[model samples]
Target: MSTTTPAKVTVITHPLVQHKLTLMRKKESSTNSFRRLLGELSTLMAYEITRDMPLQDLEIETPMEKMTGKVIDGKKQVLVSILRAGNGFLDGMLNVIPGARIGHIGLYRDPETLQPVEYYFKMPSEMQERDIIVVDPMLATGNSAVAAVERLKQLQPRSIKFVCLLAAPEGVATMQKMHPDVPIFTAAIDRELNDHGYIMPGLGDAGDRIFGTK
Candidate 1:
């Protein structure tokens, strides 16, 4: 976690996540190692993000007696991944809430403008009845994340939370300015964004690292 976090932004400081993030950040880490670390780190982050999920009491019969248990309705959860890099979080989160629905919003940042351009959008039905967790590996310029959240809002989902492996101060400010209602969760909030809108000292192009395109 960084020394400062903006209002409504949560930096997950779990040791395991921090350790894996360190490994992922190393330029020497292989694509296989980076991908695997991201998966393991995402699972840990997901656990923290869903901490406040409301639980309902359920009655069940045990071999010896009847008892009441609390459980969340996984079906009411929706994870929206922002394009290629965001897909890396899918498997780890699914491991936690297997019944949760999945969605994808394909958005890429224009090289010149650093603005988000949408190529595809798909979501589960009855969005109004579900809570959405938007996933993207890096919140650098925040353009793509902002665009994705803007689009998802059209469906009027119950709520929305943004999650990333790393975030820059500029990006967090941008998101907080535009979508103050949506909380942000990340492993770390780095120093700043570089000239080209990349997070300073970030784990390098997450999409490239995850897919080994670079």
Candidate 2:
């Protein structure tokens, strides 16, 4: 939300998205409710994220007559999950874009250094022709997101976007400094990150909440 930064960060202010996010953030929110809300929220967010996807004119026959209509080719789009937490966003997005290819990058934050350590990565072929949308629940430190994007750039995808449930100003700034070309979309932008690399007032440890690990 900082105006001084050049990063193309969009804070989704849709009423439904904000409502579900509030439900997900409550400490008393059960794992089931939290997970369900995340899926519903992701579906809403996908609507905004893919708003400008390139559309082509297609002739289609309706009940009465044939007409030209705009259509998006789902095959040219890919959703890349940033490991365990990112998978949570998959179901909802897939509901909207069922034909989109899926990819995964396994990364864990180094406890001591607060950096990302990649353990696995798998992507679909012909990535150069696909527009990539990277999903992760929280962008707190931004190290993992940065590292993941750096790796994906090697595949040279046509375009890339990062979507998350929440983001911290520090994370936004870090991403701006590192990968300004990749736009970031999030439900809300929190104030800042705590010393432990957790977003203040953020839904704590998204992976834990999603999986009930904690």
Cα deviation at 44, candidate 2, in Å, is: 0.3
Ten-residue region with minimum lDDT total, candidate 2: 1-10
Candidate 1 lDDT by residue in tens digits, 1-214: 1124434789999889999999999999999999999899999998999999989999999999999999999999999999999999999988888899999999988999999999999999999999999999999988899899899989999899999999999899999888888899999999998889989888889999999999
Candidate 2 positional error at 67, Å? 1.7
Where does candidate 1 clash, by residue pair? none
- Stretches off by above 4 angstroms in model 2 are 1-5
The per-residue C-alpha lDDT of model 2 at residue 125 equals 98
Q: Cα RMSD (Å) per model?
A: 3.5, 2.7
TM-score of each: 0.96, 0.96
State each candidate's clash count: 0, 0
Best by lDDT: 2
Q: How does candidate 1 score on lDDT?
A: 0.92
